[model samples]
Target: MRFIDSHCHLDFDELADNLTKYMSDALASGITQFVVPGISLAQSKSLLAFSQKHPSCHISFGLHPYFLTAHSRDEMALLADLAEQNSEQLVAIGECGIDSQCDDLELQQALFKSHIVLANRLGLPMIVHHRQSHHLIAQAFKQTPPQFGGVIHAFSGSLQQAQYYLKLGFKLGLGGTITYPRAKKTREVVSRLPLSSFVLETDAPSMPVFGFQGQINVPVRLIDIFAQVCQLRNESEDEIAQALYATSCRVFSI
Candidate 1:
């Protein structure tokens, strides 16, 4: 089956330790492409070197909300400059979004808005890192919609929430969460949402699949996630694979 892992952190310690091996494993599993998101200014800059080495891995640079302490007051300006300087080498403008559980929700929203504006200006899509702040995210999107559209990475929301993102031209990212038997809501959303409104992601070295919990996740687990998605949907494996590949390509224009 053809697949593209729309989100993966190949620069992270666990995966980057022996990236060549993991990359080989992913390629052998029929996964064609991988999108690596920027979690901070330093990490994003670090990714530049990785991109030069791995042409098959695409990059997107932005600050993640969870690491707000790593960001400075002029962080958005710096991120904008970095994004512009390496615009040609990047695919989207994320892993940025607000997480309600964090105390700095307001600050995260401000940064997210800046990210939205930057993405719109660059005509690039986004790889939004959403959590328990769907209303906040949807509100941000509704206020300043993304012109190139993006994916809600590691999506785990209701069908109504899923429809909201789909309506705004964004696609829901299906990851390891759906593999669990306890993910009934996410599974139900997967089973119900239109095939075109989704993309596959591993968020690797992070979101390990069901049986592999506590292990370092990798892009190859995308195949297992894809298998679960096929079971959740009515489409055949080939049909699901083709549609998901097309959606992944379209979302990032990679």
Candidate 2:
């Protein structure tokens, strides 16, 4: 029952403080690998350092839409330079994408495009963080798609949007959000989507599953997400686990 959390922010203060214990708990629950996504330049460095210490951890560096104020025009250039300098250590080029819910749509799109361009140029995958900006993100991908493809972390959209990303060579990242009964759209998409088009994630220290309300999420909770997905799709746990693991490896080239 080994599992991989395709997306998480383990560098956040909550998880970083007790990463050793968190990793131990995850291992105990059969979560072997985790992809730690960066939200900003400083977070990216912390993520890389964490990955260096933990063999099962992988790193993805980019700007998140929510942190629009922190990013400057030069940050994109700096990110490109960092990617080139640390290519050997970097696995992907995100937790980055557009967020329509925010006030700075223009800035979000600008940063999003920058990441896509860098990812395409470097032959690395992009880990997308889309929210209410699916169509815009899709359009960005159309303008400058990545050669290595990417994943849509914490996807909560319609089957049509899911199919669009699937066509664009991206895998959906399912997390604790789907376990909630109120996540009707997410549940529907998960139940209908082809198993190969998705990878499991936790988005740890956030997006905790239904049963663990108010508790900080960690990689260990991924098993709970796996079970929820299996129940929603009415598939065996082993079958779902196998498909998700293969999809993750394919997307991340692990």
lDDT of each: 0.89, 0.84
User: What TM-score do all the candidates reach, one by one?
Assistant: 0.97, 0.95
Per-residue lDDT over 37-67 for candidate 1, one digit per residue giving the tens place of the 0 to 100 score: 9988889888899888888889998989877
Clashing pairs in 2: none
User: In model 2, what lDDT does residue 43 have?
Assistant: 77
Worst 10 residues of 2 by lDDT: 67-76
Q: Over the stretch 1-254, how does candidate 2's per-residue lDDT look in tens digits?
A: 78888888777888768988998998988888888888887777677678878879889889888776754567878878888888778779998988878777878888888898888877889898877888898787777766777898899988888898888788888998899899998799999888998899999889989989888888888988888888888778888898999889888878
Cα deviation of 177, candidate 2, in Å = 1.5
| Top-lDDT structure, candidate number | 1
Model 1: worst 10 consecutive residues (lDDT sum): 66-75
Q: How many backbone clashes does candidate 1 have?
A: 0
Q: Give candidate 1 regions above 4 Å deviation.
A: none
Choose the strongest candidate by TM-score. 1
Error of 2 at 41 (Å): 1.1
